[model samples]
Target: MTAPARTSGPVEASPGRLFRHRDFRLLWTGHTVSAVGSNMTAVALPLVAVAVLDATTFQVAVLTAAAWLPWLFAGLPVGAWVDRVRRRPVMIAADLVAAALFASVPAAALLGLLTVGHLLVVALGAGLARVFFETADQVYLPTLLRPEQVPEANARLHATQTASYLVGPGLAGLIAQLVGAVTAVALDALTFLLSALCLRRISAVEARPHRGAGTTSLRREVAAGLRFVVRDPYLRVLTVFGAASNIGLTGYQAVLVVFLVRSAELPAGLVGLLIGLASLGGVVGAALAARLARRLGTARTLLFAGALTGPPALLIPLAGAGARTAWLVLGGMLVSLGVAIGNVVKGSFRQTYTPHRLLGRVTVSMHLLNYGTIPLAALLAGALGAAWGPHGAIRAMTAWLALTPLILLAGPLRRRRDLPTAPS
Candidate 1:
C-alpha cells in the first residue's frame, strides 16, 4: 500500500494520534475484533472439550498443540509466499477461512456430531490460517505507517490485543455459562466475518514484488528466508530466546484452564474473569512500553521485560483455595505485562531493522522458531499433568519460564542501551 509519509526520526506521540490515521484505524479495528474472537475461543474451545466431551487433560492440551502445529508445518514457506505476494489479500483470505472453520463447531453441535476430533481439525485449520495472517500482518504494519510511527503503531495494536485478553475471556466464560461453549465458537465466527469486512474496506494499494524470472520454488524461497534469520547475530539470538520462552509459556497455558476449574474449583465464568483480570497487566504494559523503551533504552527495557516475565510464574503453581488464587493472578499479570513490553519493543525493532523486501520472510522465520515449540510444550504440559497432576505440571513448566530470561542475557542485548536501528 502507499505508506503514510515518512518521518525522519522518532516522532512525539500525542493523544488520539491513531484516530488521525484512517487506514491504520481501520486495520487496527479489524484486528482488534479478530483478536477478541480468538481470545474467546482460547477460553471457550477448551471448555467445550472439558465440560461437554469430558475430554482428558491430555486431550484438552492436544487441542492447543493442534492449533500451534501449523507454525512448524507452513511457517517458512508461507513467509516466503507472503514476501512474494500482496500481504493484505492474504490476510483477508485467512480471516474468511478461519471464520468458516470456527463456524463449523456450532453447526456440528446442533447436528449432534460434535467431538474432540472435530475441534482438533478446526483448531488446525484456524492455526494454518493464523500462520499466514500473522506473517503478513507483521509486514503489513510497516506498509501503513512510516518508520518513526512503527513503535507507536505496535504499542497501540498490542494495547488492543492485551485489552482483548482482558475482555474476551470474561465474555467467553459468561457466554459459556449462559448459552453453551459451542455457541461461543459461533460468536467467534461472527467476529471474524466482521474482521474480513473491515479489511476489505481499507483503500491502501499494496505493492507486489516480482520474483525469480523463472527459477523460484517454495523450497528455495523458504531456505532464503531461513538463511537471513540464521545469518544475523541479533535475529539469530532473538529467535533462540523466543523459542525457549514459548516452550515454558505454552506449557503453563496448556494446563491453566484445568488447574483453575478442577484444582481451584472455580466456575467457568469466574475462571474467565480471573484470567481476564490477570491479562489486565498487558493493558498497563502496552500503555507504557514505548515510554519505557524511550526512557530505559530499548535494549535495557527488553532485559527488564525479561526479568518481569519469568520469576513471578512460580506463584501460579502455589495458587490454592480462597485468597491463594491471588497468587496465580499476580504471577500471570507479571508474565503478561513483560510479554507485552517485549513484544512492542521487539516488533518495532524487527520491522525497522529488516529490509521491506525481506520483512515477511524475516518475521516468519523468527516466528517459525518462536511458535514451533508451542505444540511440543503443550504436549509436555499434558503429559506432565497426567503424570504429576495439574498443579505439579504448572510448577515444572513455570520453573522453566523462570530460566528463559537467561537466554536473552547470553546474547549481545546487554551490551547496548537501545537496539540498533539497522541490522549489524
Candidate 2:
C-alpha cells in the first residue's frame, strides 16, 4: 500500500516561517518544555543518587545505565508499533507515562522510601517512555512540514533544546540547593505534563498508517527497517559512526558528576552552573547549523562538527579546582556545539531521505545501535571509575572519544559534499 501524501507549504519558506505553522509551533513548544525538564533530571537524578543516597561512583553510573537500558531491550518492537499508530497520540501517551514515572520519585522520597533500587526503576520507566516518544517524534515531524523546511525546523528545535541544556542544569542546581533534589525532580514531573498538554492541543491530522501486506508481522516489519538501514550506504556508515561516538560520549558523561564533585571538589551548585555554562556552545552550534550546511555543505559541516565532538574532549579531564575548571567549560562547550550541529543536519537528512512508511523503523534501527551502547559505556566507565578514580575514568573515556571521529573517515561521508537528498 502506498502511504498517503502529506500537505506541504512552499519549499522555499523562510527560516522563521515554521513559527507561523500552528501545529509545528505546538510541537516545538511542547518539545522545548519537555527538553528543559529532561535536562534538569540529567543533573537532579544523579544528585539524588549520589548526594541523597550516598551512592558510590559505580552506583551513580548505574543510574545513568538504567535510564538508557530500555533502548537496547525494547527499541526495535516499539519502532514497529509506532509505525502502526498515530504518532502524536503515541507521543502524548509516552509523555504522560514519563510524567507519572518521574512523579513517583518525589512521592517516594516524601514517604522516606527513596532508594537506589527505586531510582533505577523510575529511570528505566522513564527511559521506556523516551524510546516511544522519540521514535514517534522523528516520524511525526515530516508529516507536519514541507520536506525542504525540515533543516530549518530541526535547527530551530535544536537551538531551543540546546538552550534548555544551558538553562535546565543551572536551574536544577539552584532548586536542588534551596529545596532538595527531590523537589527539583518534582518540578521536572510537572514539565512532562505540560508537554503532554501541549501535544494534545495540536490539531494537525496524521495520515492513516499504511500497512503493506508483510508489515502486519511485527518481526518482518522490524527486519525490513533493519535491512533498509544495513543495506543503505549512508545509513550503514552513519549508524556505525554514531554507535562509536555514543560509546565514548556516554562513557565519560556517566562519571562526569562524580569527577566534578568528588575529584574536582566542586559544590553541587557550582557543578550544575559549570555544566550549564559549557552548554552555551550547543546553542551557538544549533543556530549556525543551517547556515554552515548551506555554505560548507552538509557532509563538510558534519566533518567539522565531528571534529568538534572529539579532540577538545581531552580538556575535560584536565579540569580541577578554581582556574582549571575553565577547561571543563571550553571542552564541554566544543563537544556540545559539535553534537548539536551534527544532530540538526543528520535529523533533517534522515527524515527526508528515508521512505515514509519505514521512517519509524529505520530511525529506531539506527538508534538501536547508536543508543544501545550507552548502558554498556556507562557500566564500563563506572568500573573504570571504581578501579582507578573518576579522573582516570574520564581520561580513558575522553581518549576514546578523541578517536571516534576517525570512524567517519572510513565511510563515503569523506567523499561527499552533501548527503544524498533521498536514498538512491
Candidate 3:
C-alpha cells in the first residue's frame, strides 16, 4: 500500500508556531539532551583511558576501535530492523539502554572495580545503542516534518548539536578535573534518561510491518542495502567523498591528543577548552549553510565547501612547538567551520534526493561507510605515529586529504546544478 501523501507548503517562521507541533518539539528536546550527553562521553571516554587507567597509546587506539567496530559489523542489520519496526519505540529503547550502560561506568569506578575490560564492554554497548538510535532517527525525521520544513528542521537539529559540542566538553572537563572522569560520565547517563522521557512523548504512525512469508535473513537484507547504495549515483558519490573525509579526519583525531600533549606542550584539561572554543565555528557554519547554498547553487556550494575543508588539515601540524598555542586553536576553529558547512550541504542534499521508502537503508549504508573505517584509520595513525613520530604521521594524513576534491570532480555531482526545489 502507498503511504499517505503529504501537502507541501512553507513552514511557519515563528518558533512558537513550530513548537506547537508536539511531536517535533518532543523529538527536538530528546535530541538536544542526547547530543549534550553524547558529547560528554566523547570527552570523558578518552580521558578515562589516558588519565585514569594510564593506558598506552595502543590501548587508547583499542578503546576508539571498540566503539566504532559495531558500525562496520552491525549497521546494515540494524537498519533493516529499524525499517521493520516502529521508529519511536526503537529510539526510546535505545536511550534507555544507553543510559544503563553509561551508568555502569561510574558504578564500577566508585567501587574501585573499573578496568580496561569494563571500559571496552561499555563502549561497545553504547555503540550498539547509537546504531539503533541513528538508524531510527533518519527514518523518523520525515514523518515529523513536512517536506517544506525539512531545511528548517535540519537547521534546528544541527544548531542543538553545535550547542552541545560548545558546552558539553567544557562542562565535562570541569567535572572531570574537580570530581573525576567516571563521575563526569555519570552525568551523561542522566541526560540519556531525560532523552528517553522526551522520546516517549512523540506520537506518530508506526512503520508498516514486513509482508513476506517470514522475516528476511539478515545477510540478504544487508546485501540489499549495499546493492542500493552502490547502484545509486548520488549515494555512491556521497559514500566515496564521505569515506575519504572520514579516513583523513579519523587519522587527525587519532594523533591529535598526543600531538597537543607532546608537541604543543598543553595539558589535557586545556585541550578540552580549545576544542570547545573551536566548536563555535560549527555553530556559525551551520547557521549560514542554507543561505550560502541558496546564493551559490548547491553543486558549487558543495565544491567550495569541500575545498575549504581540505586546506585546514595542513594547518594543525604546521604550528610546531611554540607559545603560539592561540594560533593552533584558531586554525583548528577554521577547520571546524569548513567541516560544519560541508556537513549541512551534504545532509540537505542527501535528504532531498533519497526516496522515503529507502531512507532507512540508504542512511545506514552511508553511515557504515562514513564511520566503518574510523577504527582502521585510528589504528594506522597510532602505529605510524609510533614509528615515524606524530608530526610526520599528521603531515602524511594532511597530504592524503588533498585528494578529497577528486571525488566531486569525477561524479555526476560535477554536472548537477542546484538541488530540485520541488519533490522528485
Prediction 2 global C-alpha lDDT: 0.90
lDDT by residue (56-100, candidate 1, tens digit) is 999999999999999998998888888788888999999999999
What does candidate 3's lDDT look like per residue over 294-377, in tens digits?
A: 777666777777776677667767654555666556766666676777777677656656776566777899999888988788
Off by over 4 Å in 1: 1-11, 210-215
lDDT of 2 by residue, 1-424 (tens): 6453332211334866778898888899898999999999999999999899999999999999999999999999999988898899999999999999999999999899999999999999999999999999999999988887887898889999999998999988888888888888888999999999999999988888875733479999999999999998878888988898898889988999888888888888888899999899999999998888888888888899999999999999899999999999999999999999998888888898899999999999999999999999999999999999989999999999999899889888888787876666
Better candidate by lDDT, 1 or 2: 2
Give TM-scores for every candidate, taking all chains together and pairing residue i with residue i: 0.96, 0.96, 0.91
* Best first by lDDT, ranked: 2, 1, 3
The Cα local distance difference test for each model comes to 0.88, 0.90, 0.75
* Top-lDDT structure, candidate number: 2
Off by over 4 Å in 3: 1-16, 207-218, 320-322, 420-424
Task: Determine the C-alpha RMSD for candidate 2 after optimal superposition of all C-alphas.
Answer: 3.4
State the TM-score for model 3.
Answer: 0.91
